[model samples]
Target: MRLAWKRWIFSLLAACTILSLHAEDEADLEQPDDVPWEEVKSTLPAYPEAGEWLPFFVTSATTNTFYIDAKSLEGTKDGVMHYTLKVVSENGAVNVTREGMRCSTREQKLYAIGDDRSKTWREPRNNQWVFFKKWAINRQLNVLYDDFFCPGRIIVYNVNDAIRALRSGVPVSGKSSRD
Candidate 1:
């Protein structure tokens, strides 16, 4: 009796498999490899150095240039750090906020950079269009600390993996690491 039952189950499973194969939607299948991909272009920075984490940035940076100012960075969770960038413009008067984007690690450690607003009417005084990255809210990055080290781009991976790379030396670029 047990053997017969086993045989019945196997036959039923085989039938189900055959039926499902025929029932699959065309959309579920992959496109034919012979078909060519559509030609497309963009004007953004591409960060190939950005490790496993799905690279995200303002201006669609990842869509173009991969160059990052390692010198303009601060502490990395392990070897990676989150980041955001803001551009300000000013002539001799007020401060204006320009393009800005916030990029966080998979674990959500924040990162951001602030620059001049480009509008003299809104520009901040006593500072020359200062640009710097803020680690924590109250904690600001030091531009000339000399002790600060910049982490690399190949740090944390995805949301599934939350480990980071640590930096102990100056980054490749000469931009301010902290502001």
Candidate 2:
């Protein structure tokens, strides 16, 4: 009878230790590293031509139509995805931006802004990576993060994968690829 009790206790302790170790591993995955993040240098993309812009759906409340330049989609070696985005307002004004998104950290950084008149790109004065905000009025980054580019917190495997997700209107992580 004493041997049976010892075995049961041993089994319980072993299970507890395994579970504890698994929990620690999960915590480690969730924690950010103490090392400062260094962003890879990005080059500004050319101004998106009207024909190259592919429209994407954002929130219904927004009057602006969002688009991604089909030709500008790029996946970098450092896990940063670069693309040029275009925003067309209902009033006929257009805004273009070249940006990079880091799927692992849910952060985005603006690389440059496009001038439609001169067809030139200019760097933003405050270019930096910022986390996506849940309550932002314009949830373009969130839509891209959750529905297309960074689904499941993993970036699309390549530029073609990103383009596929954009064209199919389905997330990269989705079980079914519409296209």
**Window of ten residues with lowest summed lDDT in model 1:** 97-106
TM-score of each: 0.18, 0.74
For model 2, the local distance difference test gives 0.73
**Model 1 RMSD, rounded to 1 decimal:** 24.4
Candidate 1 at 146: error in angstroms?
A: 29
Worst lDDT run of 10 residues, candidate 2, spans 22-31
lDDT string for model 1 (39-142, tens) is: 12211222213223221122211122112233223233333333322222223331112111112211222212223343122223342212333222212222
Best by TM-score: 2
| Segments of candidate 2 deviating more than 4 angstroms | 1-36, 175-179
Model 1 clashes, total count: 36
lDDT of 2 by residue, 59-135 (tens): 65567899998898887766678888989998989898999888777778899998989988997997877765433
Compute the lDDT of residue 143 as modeled in candidate 2. 80
